[model samples]
Target: MTRVDLNADMGESFGPWPMGDDASLLKTVTSANIACGGHAGDADTMARTMAMAQGNNVGIGAHPGFMDLAGFGRNRMSVPRGTLQNQIRYQVAASVGMARAVGAKVRHLKLHGALSNMASEDAALARDCYEAALSVDPDLIVMILAETAQQEAVRELGCRWASEIFADRAYNDDATLVDRSKPGAVIHDPDLAGKRMVEMVKAGAIITESGKQIPAAIDTICLHGDTPTAVQIATHVRRALEAAGITVQTFDGR
Candidate 1:
């Protein structure tokens, strides 16, 4: 049977601003990518999220990003290679510490937002992030965008990797995510989103906005927690995949 991991970014609430209702979302996804301190999480939020994930038996992952809290780590920034590697290492290590405190394990390392996109195309940034993740824990899986330079670098380091696909975002012919600023970039309708997800999982391919079919070796599909209809989209997609006999689980669980 084919299996795919359902993951979402959680623990984003920092200080007085509360983000997504992660506790509820935890019941839905098999894996939780908890945000570390760099992007959008605090010590209290991290502790709470880690405990909740442990209680729900959801596998935890470190979601590391640039140290741009003002931009929510979505804005591109120029930083030295060593600085990038150190920041990623600090965030992942912080998350691993929190998870271990609650008796939970850090199963993977997933880079967030702009850093993730940059790493996909930039060999230098990818190598830095890959090295940081392995430095934290050599056994941790790296969840990276497939068909990117980062995947190649991660594999060269002998670390396990999971190919990540987005359920709500449209893709270009080159298998890159369509710019969010463009029209039709995000599928907000739950039914349509469900249909797209079903097509991708069933065929192991997705048709881009330019009408080109792209093959994806998908081991995981991501649903952004910040989306308004995220829960509905996640629920419907999970049901659709299950009906098609695809098991939902984390990479480690598989």
Candidate 2:
């Protein structure tokens, strides 16, 4: 691919508690996957983030997770199927409505935290979430973790979708992200993160830790905005992609 999208999980700051330097990160990313008051954001945070994303001309997306703010949505939960679907719908609706109110529009949908990890492995979970979001907006692009059950769910649904790899997370042989608690799972070095992303994008595949290249439709690279060096990684990744003659821009979901 000659081009790819740079996206970040954003709008995570809670009331009276700020997180991440979103203002600086926004200057580098092409798309913003905003939290929808589920895992890490509130109404005011969503409005503020969407307006800033619009001002930056970045694409906006709904980022919903298990409504476990105490766990930051990283700790998994076991809820009934129908209730989980409704939770996703509720979060997505809030995001879409808030964006419209701010004169911005959500173009895509991405799951967050443990919800995303589970969906990456379970097609049923991923489809349920995607279907719930689609029920609200048919045109919303379902962003999937490439080479996983998430992608399988998208293909089965026959919906507009984009496939993404991570800029800072290590991958396993099966294309799953290394557990966050594991050592070296999350790359904190800006230069190393940039190098890994460029290599994966150029190869048109996810290069696993075992040196396996799983050919896939790589569309975007995700940067974790809550990390300490999020802006640095974003900036360097964009620069690295450009230096390698790969255009860093928004993804037009297929």
Candidate 3:
């Protein structure tokens, strides 16, 4: 049986500023990449989100990004390599300690926003960010964007990792994500998103917008929780995968 994990970003809500319907999203996703205060989320949100994930038996992950709360970490920034590494270490440590306090454990580490995009294209940067996280938890599972430099970093490091494809985002012919500013870059139609995921998972590759199939490992599918139709897309993707006889569960890394 073909199996894949469904993951969603959560815990982005700051104090008095709630973001993403985590409760509803948790019902459909098997794994959660929770924001660890670098881009979004706070100590309170982390504890609350971790508690919710533990109650639902969902796998928890530390989501660290560039410290740009004003930009939600989506805006790309140039930071020193050592600073970026320390940022990752700091965020992962916070996630690990908080999860322990809530009686939950963070099983994985996923880079967020611009940091993820940058790492997808730069192997050295990907290694630096992931290395910092691994320093905190040597057994941590690193989630990499499939068919990208992030994957290259993981392969070279010989660490446990999972390859991920996005359900709501379009792919370039080179397998990098289409820029968000482009038309049709972000798929909003739930049906289309669901159909695309089913196709990629069954083929064990990333089906680019140009109809090119880049052969890669498809261990998990991500549904961005900040989008308006994120929850709907996630629900449809789950149903579509199950309908096509694909098993959705937590990933054990590749």
Stretches of candidate 2 above 4 Å error?
none
The best-first sequence of candidates by lDDT reads: 3, 2, 1
Residues 17-121, model 2: lDDT tens digits: 999988898999999999999899999999999999999999999999999999999999998999999999999999999999999999999999999999999
Model 2 TM-score?
A: 0.99
Residue 210 in candidate 2, Cα distance off native in Å: 1.5
**Candidate 2: deviation at residue 7, Å?**
0.1
Q: Over the stretch 1-254, how does candidate 1's per-residue lDDT look in tens digits?
A: 78888998999999999988897788888888999988899999999998998898888999999998998998988888888888888998999898888888899889998888888887678878889878989888888886677777776776788888888999887677787789988888877776777788777876788767778778888988878888888888888888878899876621
What lDDT score is found at residue 155 in candidate 2?
Answer: 93
Global lDDT of each candidate: 0.85, 0.95, 0.96
1-254: candidate 3 lDDT, tens digit per residue: 99999999999999999999999999999999999999999999999999999999999999999999999999999999999899999999999999999999999999998999999999999999999999999999999999899999999999999999999999998889999999999999999999999999999889998899999899999999999999999999999999999999999987
Lowest-scoring 10 consecutive residues by lDDT in candidate 2? 194-203
Q: How many backbone clashes does candidate 3 have?
A: 0
Q: Which portions of model 3 miss their true places by more than 4 Å?
A: none
For residue 124, give model 2's deviation from the true position in Å. 0.8
CA-RMSD of model 3: 0.6
Residue-level error in angstroms, candidate 2, position 224: 0.2
Per-candidate TM-scores read 0.96, 0.99, 0.99
Candidate 3 local accuracy as lDDT?
0.96
Error at 108, model 2, angstroms: 0.2
Cα error of candidate 2 at position 34, Å? 0.2
